[model samples]
Target: SNRFSYSMNLKGASMTIDTACSSSLVCTHVSKLHLRYKDNEIMPASVVNGLNLMLFPGPFVGCCAAGMLSHEGRCFTFNSTADGYARGELCGALLFKAKQFNPADGGLCCLAGSQTNQDGRSASLTAPNGPAQEKCIAAVLKEVGLTPTEVDCIECHGTGTSLGDP
Candidate 1:
Protein backbone atom coordinates (compact mmCIF):
# COMPACT_ATOMS: atom_id res chain seq x y z
CA SER A 1 0.00 0.00 0.00
CA ASN A 2 1.09 3.59 -0.60
CA ARG A 3 0.91 4.33 3.10
CA PHE A 4 3.67 1.79 3.81
CA SER A 5 5.72 2.22 0.63
CA TYR A 6 5.96 6.01 0.89
CA SER A 7 8.55 5.77 3.66
CA MET A 8 10.64 3.26 1.73
CA ASN A 9 11.08 5.76 -1.09
CA LEU A 10 13.24 7.91 1.21
CA LYS A 11 16.12 5.41 0.82
CA GLY A 12 16.64 5.00 4.56
CA ALA A 13 15.84 2.21 6.97
CA SER A 14 12.19 2.18 7.98
CA MET A 15 10.02 0.17 10.38
CA THR A 16 6.65 0.23 12.05
CA ILE A 17 5.70 0.12 15.73
CA ASP A 18 2.42 -1.37 16.98
CA THR A 19 2.78 -0.81 20.71
CA ALA A 20 -0.54 0.65 21.72
CA CYS A 21 -0.26 4.15 23.30
CA SER A 22 3.57 4.10 23.39
CA SER A 23 4.07 3.56 19.67
CA SER A 24 5.02 7.11 18.72
CA LEU A 25 7.36 7.69 21.64
CA VAL A 26 8.98 4.30 21.05
CA CYS A 27 9.52 5.16 17.39
CA THR A 28 11.16 8.43 18.37
CA HIS A 29 13.55 6.51 20.62
CA VAL A 30 14.50 4.21 17.75
CA SER A 31 15.06 7.17 15.42
CA LYS A 32 17.36 8.78 17.95
CA LEU A 33 19.36 5.58 18.17
CA HIS A 34 19.75 5.32 14.42
CA LEU A 35 20.94 8.91 14.21
CA ARG A 36 23.47 8.23 16.95
CA TYR A 37 25.00 5.05 15.54
CA LYS A 38 24.29 5.02 11.80
CA ASP A 39 26.03 7.18 9.25
CA ASN A 40 24.35 10.55 9.36
CA GLU A 41 25.23 11.24 5.74
CA ILE A 42 23.24 8.27 4.53
CA MET A 43 20.30 8.55 6.93
CA PRO A 44 20.21 12.19 7.88
CA ALA A 45 16.55 12.34 8.78
CA SER A 46 13.72 10.20 10.15
CA VAL A 47 9.99 10.75 10.05
CA VAL A 48 7.56 9.35 12.59
CA ASN A 49 3.82 9.29 12.07
CA GLY A 50 1.04 8.21 14.42
CA LEU A 51 -2.45 7.81 13.02
CA ASN A 52 -5.45 6.63 14.98
CA LEU A 53 -8.93 6.39 13.54
CA MET A 54 -11.41 5.09 16.07
CA LEU A 55 -14.52 5.15 13.90
CA PHE A 56 -14.85 1.40 14.09
CA PRO A 57 -17.15 -0.06 16.74
CA GLY A 58 -15.31 -3.36 17.32
CA PRO A 59 -12.51 -2.00 19.48
CA PHE A 60 -14.87 0.40 21.17
CA VAL A 61 -17.08 -2.49 22.24
CA GLY A 62 -14.08 -4.38 23.59
CA CYS A 63 -12.93 -1.38 25.59
CA CYS A 64 -16.41 -0.95 26.97
CA ALA A 65 -16.56 -4.60 28.03
CA ALA A 66 -13.18 -4.29 29.73
CA GLY A 67 -14.32 -1.08 31.51
CA MET A 68 -11.58 0.90 29.82
CA LEU A 69 -13.87 3.50 28.35
CA SER A 70 -15.06 6.56 30.21
CA HIS A 71 -18.67 6.13 31.33
CA GLU A 72 -19.01 9.89 31.46
CA GLY A 73 -17.38 10.29 28.06
CA ARG A 74 -14.46 12.31 29.37
CA CYS A 75 -10.81 11.80 30.19
CA PHE A 76 -10.35 12.98 33.77
CA THR A 77 -6.61 12.58 33.87
CA PHE A 78 -5.09 12.86 37.35
CA ASN A 79 -8.40 13.80 38.86
CA SER A 80 -10.51 12.26 41.57
CA THR A 81 -13.22 11.48 39.05
CA ALA A 82 -10.82 9.61 36.83
CA ASP A 83 -12.59 6.56 35.49
CA GLY A 84 -11.68 5.48 31.98
CA TYR A 85 -10.55 7.14 28.78
CA ALA A 86 -12.52 8.69 25.92
CA ARG A 87 -11.27 7.33 22.65
CA GLY A 88 -10.73 9.65 19.70
CA GLU A 89 -8.94 9.85 16.39
CA LEU A 90 -5.50 11.41 16.31
CA CYS A 91 -2.95 12.04 13.55
CA GLY A 92 0.50 13.40 14.18
CA ALA A 93 3.92 13.39 12.57
CA LEU A 94 7.42 14.43 13.62
CA LEU A 95 10.73 14.67 11.82
CA PHE A 96 14.10 14.08 13.49
CA LYS A 97 17.64 14.60 12.29
CA ALA A 98 21.16 14.19 13.61
CA LYS A 99 22.51 16.96 15.78
CA GLN A 100 25.09 17.94 13.16
CA PHE A 101 22.30 18.59 10.65
CA ASN A 102 20.85 21.30 12.91
CA PRO A 103 17.20 20.16 12.72
CA ALA A 104 16.32 23.24 14.75
CA ASP A 105 16.20 25.11 11.44
CA GLY A 106 13.11 23.07 10.56
CA GLY A 107 11.75 22.53 14.08
CA LEU A 108 11.82 24.36 17.35
CA CYS A 109 13.68 21.60 19.22
CA CYS A 110 15.37 18.20 18.85
CA LEU A 111 15.35 15.04 20.89
CA ALA A 112 18.22 15.01 23.42
CA GLY A 113 17.86 11.30 24.16
CA SER A 114 15.34 8.50 24.72
CA GLN A 115 15.02 5.08 26.38
CA THR A 116 12.53 2.19 26.32
CA ASN A 117 11.70 -0.81 28.52
CA GLN A 118 9.01 -3.42 28.93
CA ASP A 119 6.80 -4.55 31.80
CA GLY A 120 8.04 -8.12 32.06
CA ARG A 121 5.83 -10.64 33.87
CA SER A 122 3.09 -8.29 34.88
CA ALA A 123 -0.06 -9.51 36.66
CA SER A 124 -1.83 -9.57 33.32
CA LEU A 125 -0.91 -8.75 29.76
CA THR A 126 -3.33 -5.81 29.74
CA ALA A 127 -2.58 -4.57 33.24
CA PRO A 128 -0.12 -1.71 33.73
CA ASN A 129 2.80 -2.46 36.05
CA GLY A 130 3.90 0.30 38.39
CA PRO A 131 7.42 -0.96 38.93
CA ALA A 132 8.06 -1.26 35.21
CA GLN A 133 6.79 2.27 34.62
CA GLU A 134 9.11 3.56 37.33
CA LYS A 135 12.07 1.77 35.80
CA CYS A 136 11.33 3.16 32.34
CA ILE A 137 11.16 6.72 33.62
CA ALA A 138 14.35 6.35 35.63
CA ALA A 139 16.20 4.89 32.66
CA VAL A 140 15.18 7.69 30.30
CA LEU A 141 16.14 10.33 32.83
CA LYS A 142 19.52 8.68 33.30
CA GLU A 143 20.08 8.50 29.55
CA VAL A 144 19.35 12.22 29.22
CA GLY A 145 21.62 13.01 32.20
CA LEU A 146 18.80 14.66 34.14
CA THR A 147 17.37 14.05 37.58
CA PRO A 148 13.70 14.01 38.51
CA THR A 149 14.03 17.40 40.23
CA GLU A 150 15.59 18.99 37.15
CA VAL A 151 12.71 18.14 34.83
CA ASP A 152 9.78 20.54 35.00
CA CYS A 153 7.31 19.11 32.49
CA ILE A 154 6.40 15.61 31.40
CA GLU A 155 3.94 14.41 28.78
CA CYS A 156 2.17 11.19 29.61
CA HIS A 157 -0.30 8.92 27.88
CA GLY A 158 -3.29 9.53 30.10
CA THR A 159 -5.32 6.46 29.21
CA GLY A 160 -7.78 7.48 31.96
CA THR A 161 -8.31 3.92 33.14
CA SER A 162 -8.70 3.40 36.87
CA LEU A 163 -5.94 0.81 37.12
CA GLY A 164 -3.82 2.51 34.48
CA ASP A 165 -3.82 6.04 35.94
CA PRO A 166 -1.34 6.84 38.67
Candidate 2:
Protein backbone atom coordinates (compact mmCIF):
# COMPACT_ATOMS: atom_id res chain seq x y z
CA SER A 1 0.00 0.00 0.00
CA ASN A 2 2.82 2.41 0.88
CA ARG A 3 4.69 1.85 -2.39
CA PHE A 4 1.49 2.05 -4.44
CA SER A 5 0.40 5.27 -2.76
CA TYR A 6 3.82 6.88 -3.34
CA SER A 7 3.89 5.83 -6.99
CA MET A 8 0.29 6.60 -7.93
CA ASN A 9 1.48 8.67 -10.91
CA LEU A 10 3.46 5.73 -12.27
CA LYS A 11 1.35 3.41 -14.41
CA GLY A 12 2.61 -0.17 -14.49
CA ALA A 13 2.42 -3.52 -12.74
CA SER A 14 4.06 -4.32 -9.41
CA MET A 15 4.57 -7.60 -7.55
CA THR A 16 6.43 -9.19 -4.67
CA ILE A 17 8.14 -12.58 -4.61
CA ASP A 18 9.29 -14.72 -1.71
CA THR A 19 11.58 -17.40 -3.11
CA ALA A 20 13.93 -17.55 -0.16
CA CYS A 21 17.51 -17.16 -1.39
CA SER A 22 16.60 -16.68 -5.08
CA SER A 23 13.93 -14.01 -4.55
CA SER A 24 15.94 -11.10 -5.96
CA LEU A 25 17.25 -13.06 -8.91
CA VAL A 26 13.74 -14.16 -9.83
CA CYS A 27 12.52 -10.55 -9.62
CA THR A 28 15.22 -9.44 -12.06
CA HIS A 29 14.29 -12.23 -14.42
CA VAL A 30 10.63 -11.23 -14.34
CA SER A 31 11.54 -7.57 -14.91
CA LYS A 32 13.65 -8.50 -17.90
CA LEU A 33 10.74 -10.43 -19.36
CA HIS A 34 8.39 -7.48 -18.78
CA LEU A 35 10.71 -5.13 -20.63
CA ARG A 36 11.13 -7.59 -23.48
CA TYR A 37 7.38 -7.94 -23.95
CA LYS A 38 5.82 -4.63 -22.82
CA ASP A 39 8.34 -2.10 -24.21
CA ASN A 40 8.41 1.58 -23.11
CA GLU A 41 4.83 2.44 -24.06
CA ILE A 42 3.31 0.43 -21.24
CA MET A 43 6.26 0.31 -18.82
CA PRO A 44 9.26 2.61 -18.83
CA ALA A 45 11.28 1.13 -15.97
CA SER A 46 11.39 -1.82 -13.52
CA VAL A 47 12.56 -1.64 -9.94
CA VAL A 48 13.79 -4.82 -8.23
CA ASN A 49 14.39 -4.70 -4.53
CA GLY A 50 15.27 -7.19 -1.75
CA LEU A 51 15.16 -6.65 1.97
CA ASN A 52 16.23 -9.23 4.58
CA LEU A 53 15.54 -8.38 8.18
CA MET A 54 16.74 -11.00 10.63
CA LEU A 55 14.56 -11.16 13.72
CA PHE A 56 16.41 -12.18 16.82
CA PRO A 57 15.47 -15.27 18.95
CA GLY A 58 12.86 -16.58 16.50
CA PRO A 59 14.92 -17.15 13.34
CA PHE A 60 18.12 -17.46 15.35
CA VAL A 61 16.74 -20.35 17.39
CA GLY A 62 15.29 -22.01 14.32
CA CYS A 63 18.58 -21.84 12.44
CA CYS A 64 20.44 -23.09 15.45
CA ALA A 65 18.10 -26.04 15.79
CA ALA A 66 18.46 -26.81 12.11
CA GLY A 67 22.26 -26.73 12.43
CA MET A 68 22.45 -23.94 9.83
CA LEU A 69 24.11 -21.38 12.07
CA SER A 70 27.89 -21.29 12.11
CA HIS A 71 29.48 -22.16 15.45
CA GLU A 72 32.34 -19.74 14.84
CA GLY A 73 30.00 -17.04 13.57
CA ARG A 74 31.78 -16.80 10.18
CA CYS A 75 30.73 -17.57 6.63
CA PHE A 76 33.53 -19.57 5.03
CA THR A 77 32.08 -19.52 1.52
CA PHE A 78 34.25 -22.09 -0.38
CA ASN A 79 36.68 -22.85 2.36
CA SER A 80 38.02 -26.11 3.82
CA THR A 81 36.44 -25.35 7.19
CA ALA A 82 33.00 -24.61 5.71
CA ASP A 83 30.41 -25.64 8.23
CA GLY A 84 27.35 -23.37 8.27
CA TYR A 85 26.29 -19.84 7.41
CA ALA A 86 26.41 -16.74 9.57
CA ARG A 87 23.18 -14.80 9.39
CA GLY A 88 23.22 -11.19 8.22
CA GLU A 89 20.78 -8.46 7.21
CA LEU A 90 20.75 -6.94 3.74
CA CYS A 91 18.71 -4.37 1.75
CA GLY A 92 19.24 -3.38 -1.89
CA ALA A 93 17.39 -2.17 -4.95
CA LEU A 94 18.11 -1.96 -8.70
CA LEU A 95 16.48 -0.07 -11.54
CA PHE A 96 16.32 -1.55 -15.04
CA LYS A 97 15.35 -0.26 -18.49
CA ALA A 98 15.41 -1.81 -21.91
CA LYS A 99 18.60 -1.41 -23.94
CA GLN A 100 16.65 0.32 -26.74
CA PHE A 101 15.63 3.07 -24.33
CA ASN A 102 19.15 4.58 -24.44
CA PRO A 103 21.43 2.85 -26.93
CA ALA A 104 24.45 5.09 -26.32
CA ASP A 105 24.21 4.76 -22.52
CA GLY A 106 25.28 1.18 -21.71
CA GLY A 107 24.65 1.66 -18.00
CA LEU A 108 26.66 -0.20 -15.31
CA CYS A 109 26.17 -3.79 -16.50
CA CYS A 110 24.07 -5.83 -18.88
CA LEU A 111 21.97 -8.83 -17.85
CA ALA A 112 21.79 -11.32 -20.70
CA GLY A 113 19.15 -13.48 -19.06
CA SER A 114 18.10 -15.26 -15.86
CA GLN A 115 16.25 -18.46 -14.89
CA THR A 116 15.07 -20.03 -11.63
CA ASN A 117 13.70 -23.41 -10.52
CA GLN A 118 12.84 -25.42 -7.45
CA ASP A 119 14.58 -28.58 -6.26
CA GLY A 120 11.58 -30.81 -6.65
CA ARG A 121 11.47 -34.28 -5.00
CA SER A 122 14.75 -33.70 -3.27
CA ALA A 123 15.84 -35.63 -0.18
CA SER A 124 14.53 -32.79 1.97
CA LEU A 125 12.86 -29.45 1.39
CA THR A 126 16.01 -27.57 2.33
CA ALA A 127 18.45 -29.98 0.67
CA PRO A 128 20.18 -28.86 -2.51
CA ASN A 129 19.61 -30.74 -5.78
CA GLY A 130 22.75 -30.95 -7.90
CA PRO A 131 21.05 -32.22 -11.07
CA ALA A 132 18.26 -29.64 -10.82
CA GLN A 133 20.80 -26.87 -10.34
CA GLU A 134 22.77 -28.05 -13.39
CA LYS A 135 19.59 -28.13 -15.46
CA CYS A 136 18.78 -24.55 -14.45
CA ILE A 137 22.28 -23.39 -15.46
CA ALA A 138 22.00 -25.16 -18.79
CA ALA A 139 18.60 -23.62 -19.42
CA VAL A 140 19.88 -20.09 -18.70
CA LEU A 141 22.90 -20.59 -20.94
CA LYS A 142 20.71 -21.91 -23.76
CA GLU A 143 18.28 -19.00 -23.35
CA VAL A 144 21.11 -16.43 -23.67
CA GLY A 145 22.78 -18.29 -26.57
CA LEU A 146 25.99 -18.74 -24.60
CA THR A 147 28.14 -21.65 -23.46
CA PRO A 148 29.24 -22.40 -19.92
CA THR A 149 32.85 -21.43 -20.64
CA GLU A 150 31.82 -18.07 -22.10
CA VAL A 151 30.27 -16.88 -18.83
CA ASP A 152 32.64 -15.11 -16.44
CA CYS A 153 31.02 -14.68 -13.02
CA ILE A 154 27.92 -16.00 -11.26
CA GLU A 155 26.53 -15.05 -7.86
CA CYS A 156 25.23 -18.20 -6.20
CA HIS A 157 23.48 -19.05 -2.94
CA GLY A 158 26.45 -20.17 -0.90
CA THR A 159 24.94 -20.62 2.56
CA GLY A 160 28.17 -22.30 3.79
CA THR A 161 26.42 -25.62 4.51
CA SER A 162 28.69 -28.60 3.82
CA LEU A 163 25.99 -30.55 1.99
CA GLY A 164 24.46 -27.47 0.38
CA ASP A 165 27.73 -26.21 -1.21
CA PRO A 166 27.74 -28.49 -4.22
Candidate 3:
Protein backbone atom coordinates (compact mmCIF):
# COMPACT_ATOMS: atom_id res chain seq x y z
CA SER A 1 0.00 0.00 0.00
CA ASN A 2 2.77 2.41 0.85
CA ARG A 3 4.55 1.60 -2.36
CA PHE A 4 1.40 2.02 -4.39
CA SER A 5 0.63 5.30 -2.69
CA TYR A 6 4.12 6.61 -3.34
CA SER A 7 4.07 5.64 -7.00
CA MET A 8 0.49 6.76 -7.68
CA ASN A 9 0.73 9.92 -5.57
CA LEU A 10 -2.29 8.83 -3.59
CA LYS A 11 -2.55 10.31 -0.10
CA GLY A 12 -4.99 7.93 1.47
CA ALA A 13 -4.40 5.75 4.50
CA SER A 14 -1.71 3.15 4.01
CA MET A 15 -1.79 0.26 6.43
CA THR A 16 -1.26 -3.47 6.57
CA ILE A 17 -3.64 -6.01 8.01
CA ASP A 18 -2.61 -9.51 9.06
CA THR A 19 -5.38 -11.83 10.18
CA ALA A 20 -3.92 -14.89 8.56
CA CYS A 21 -6.31 -16.14 5.87
CA SER A 22 -8.94 -13.53 6.62
CA SER A 23 -6.68 -10.56 6.00
CA SER A 24 -8.14 -9.61 2.63
CA LEU A 25 -11.73 -10.22 3.70
CA VAL A 26 -11.28 -7.97 6.72
CA CYS A 27 -9.99 -5.28 4.41
CA THR A 28 -13.37 -5.20 2.66
CA HIS A 29 -15.12 -4.65 5.98
CA VAL A 30 -12.69 -1.90 6.92
CA SER A 31 -13.12 -0.29 3.51
CA LYS A 32 -16.87 -0.01 4.03
CA LEU A 33 -16.38 1.77 7.32
CA HIS A 34 -13.89 4.17 5.83
CA LEU A 35 -16.13 4.94 2.87
CA ARG A 36 -19.35 5.24 4.86
CA TYR A 37 -17.81 7.55 7.40
CA LYS A 38 -15.06 9.64 5.87
CA ASP A 39 -13.77 11.85 8.70
CA ASN A 40 -11.93 14.05 6.23
CA GLU A 41 -13.38 15.83 3.25
CA ILE A 42 -10.52 14.74 0.99
CA MET A 43 -11.18 11.04 1.52
CA PRO A 44 -10.86 9.28 -1.80
CA ALA A 45 -11.64 5.73 -2.83
CA SER A 46 -10.20 2.77 -0.96
CA VAL A 47 -8.04 0.08 -2.52
CA VAL A 48 -7.97 -3.21 -0.63
CA ASN A 49 -5.03 -5.31 -1.68
CA GLY A 50 -3.85 -8.76 -0.62
CA LEU A 51 -0.58 -10.45 -1.46
CA ASN A 52 0.75 -13.92 -0.76
CA LEU A 53 4.37 -14.52 -1.68
CA MET A 54 6.55 -17.49 -1.00
CA LEU A 55 9.90 -15.83 -0.82
CA PHE A 56 11.62 -18.71 0.93
CA PRO A 57 11.08 -22.39 1.71
CA GLY A 58 10.82 -21.88 5.47
CA PRO A 59 7.00 -21.76 5.63
CA PHE A 60 6.58 -24.54 3.12
CA VAL A 61 9.09 -26.71 4.92
CA GLY A 62 7.40 -26.06 8.25
CA CYS A 63 3.88 -26.89 7.06
CA CYS A 64 5.23 -29.92 5.26
CA ALA A 65 7.05 -31.11 8.37
CA ALA A 66 3.90 -30.59 10.43
CA GLY A 67 1.80 -32.51 7.92
CA MET A 68 -0.39 -29.50 7.18
CA LEU A 69 0.07 -29.62 3.44
CA SER A 70 -1.92 -31.63 0.94
CA HIS A 71 0.05 -34.39 -0.72
CA GLU A 72 -1.91 -33.79 -3.92
CA GLY A 73 -0.92 -30.09 -3.97
CA ARG A 74 -4.58 -29.12 -4.00
CA CYS A 75 -7.17 -28.11 -1.42
CA PHE A 76 -10.04 -30.42 -0.47
CA THR A 77 -11.89 -27.90 1.63
CA PHE A 78 -14.91 -29.06 3.67
CA ASN A 79 -14.52 -32.62 2.44
CA SER A 80 -13.96 -35.62 4.68
CA THR A 81 -11.16 -36.58 2.32
CA ALA A 82 -9.32 -33.38 3.14
CA ASP A 83 -5.82 -34.09 4.34
CA GLY A 84 -4.44 -30.58 4.60
CA TYR A 85 -4.40 -27.13 3.10
CA ALA A 86 -2.67 -26.02 -0.08
CA ARG A 87 -0.46 -22.97 -0.38
CA GLY A 88 -0.01 -20.62 -3.31
CA GLU A 89 1.12 -17.17 -4.31
CA LEU A 90 -1.35 -14.49 -5.33
CA CYS A 91 -1.71 -10.71 -5.47
CA GLY A 92 -5.13 -9.13 -5.79
CA ALA A 93 -6.76 -5.79 -5.17
CA LEU A 94 -10.22 -4.29 -5.06
CA LEU A 95 -11.17 -0.63 -5.40
CA PHE A 96 -14.10 0.68 -3.42
CA LYS A 97 -16.04 3.90 -3.87
CA ALA A 98 -19.35 5.33 -2.79
CA LYS A 99 -22.20 4.39 -5.07
CA GLN A 100 -22.92 7.95 -6.11
CA PHE A 101 -19.30 8.63 -7.05
CA ASN A 102 -18.75 5.14 -8.45
CA PRO A 103 -18.79 4.75 -12.21
CA ALA A 104 -21.40 2.39 -13.62
CA ASP A 105 -18.92 0.58 -15.81
CA GLY A 106 -16.86 -2.28 -14.43
CA GLY A 107 -18.57 -2.30 -11.06
CA LEU A 108 -18.26 -5.48 -9.06
CA CYS A 109 -20.34 -5.65 -5.87
CA CYS A 110 -21.90 -3.11 -3.60
CA LEU A 111 -20.82 -2.62 -0.01
CA ALA A 112 -23.98 -2.77 2.07
CA GLY A 113 -22.77 -4.03 5.46
CA SER A 114 -19.97 -6.18 6.79
CA GLN A 115 -19.21 -7.78 10.14
CA THR A 116 -16.38 -9.68 11.77
CA ASN A 117 -16.12 -12.06 14.71
CA GLN A 118 -13.95 -14.69 16.28
CA ASP A 119 -14.51 -17.90 18.16
CA GLY A 120 -13.84 -16.96 21.79
CA ARG A 121 -13.97 -20.50 23.08
CA SER A 122 -13.03 -23.49 20.99
CA ALA A 123 -11.61 -26.97 21.14
CA SER A 124 -8.38 -25.61 19.77
CA LEU A 125 -6.96 -22.20 19.01
CA THR A 126 -7.31 -22.74 15.26
CA ALA A 127 -10.35 -24.98 15.29
CA PRO A 128 -13.38 -23.51 13.54
CA ASN A 129 -16.80 -23.15 15.14
CA GLY A 130 -19.62 -23.56 12.67
CA PRO A 131 -22.28 -21.99 14.86
CA ALA A 132 -20.26 -18.83 15.46
CA GLN A 133 -19.77 -18.35 11.74
CA GLU A 134 -23.44 -18.93 11.06
CA LYS A 135 -24.38 -16.30 13.63
CA CYS A 136 -22.01 -13.79 12.12
CA ILE A 137 -23.42 -14.35 8.64
CA ALA A 138 -26.94 -14.08 9.95
CA ALA A 139 -26.12 -10.82 11.70
CA VAL A 140 -24.68 -9.36 8.53
CA LEU A 141 -27.79 -10.31 6.60
CA LYS A 142 -29.97 -8.75 9.25
CA GLU A 143 -27.90 -5.58 9.23
CA VAL A 144 -28.37 -5.36 5.47
CA GLY A 145 -32.10 -6.00 5.86
CA LEU A 146 -31.94 -9.31 4.02
CA THR A 147 -32.64 -12.93 4.84
CA PRO A 148 -30.86 -16.16 4.09
CA THR A 149 -33.40 -17.10 1.42
CA GLU A 150 -33.09 -13.70 -0.23
CA VAL A 151 -29.36 -14.08 -0.62
CA ASP A 152 -28.46 -16.19 -3.59
CA CYS A 153 -24.74 -16.68 -3.05
CA ILE A 154 -21.99 -15.99 -0.58
CA GLU A 155 -18.22 -15.99 -0.81
CA CYS A 156 -16.24 -18.10 1.62
CA HIS A 157 -12.61 -18.69 2.52
CA GLY A 158 -11.43 -22.09 3.57
CA THR A 159 -8.00 -23.29 4.60
CA GLY A 160 -8.71 -26.66 2.96
CA THR A 161 -7.18 -28.53 5.84
CA SER A 162 -8.66 -31.38 7.81
CA LEU A 163 -8.48 -29.34 11.01
CA GLY A 164 -4.87 -28.45 10.25
CA ASP A 165 -4.25 -32.10 10.88
CA PRO A 166 -1.10 -33.56 12.20
Q: Would you estimate the TM-scores of all the predictions?
A: 0.87, 0.87, 0.89
Cα lDDT of model 3 by residue, 1-166, tens digit: 7888899887878878899889998988888788778854566578899999999999999999988888988888867778888889999988887545444667766777788999898888888888888999988998899988988877887767878422
Best by lDDT: 3
**What TM-score would you give candidate 3 relative to the actual structure?**
0.89
Could you arrange the candidates by TM-score from highest to lowest?
A: 3, 1, 2
Model 1 Cα lDDT, one tens digit per residue, 1-166: 2455574576677677888878888888888898889999998888888878877799999988988888899998877677998888998988787765454576667576677888888888877788888998998898889999998777777667767665
lDDT of 2 at 87: 79
Off by over 4 Å in 1: 1-8, 100-104
Question: Model 2 off-target regions past 4 Å?
Answer: 1-10, 101-106
lDDT of each: 0.80, 0.81, 0.82
- Positional deviation of 45 in candidate 2, in angstroms? 1.2
lDDT of 2 by residue, 1-166 (tens): 2485266554577787888778899989888889888867778777788888876579889889989878889888767677898878998988798655454685677778888888889898988788998999999999989998999998777778887764
Task: Assess candidate 1 and give its lDDT.
Answer: 0.80
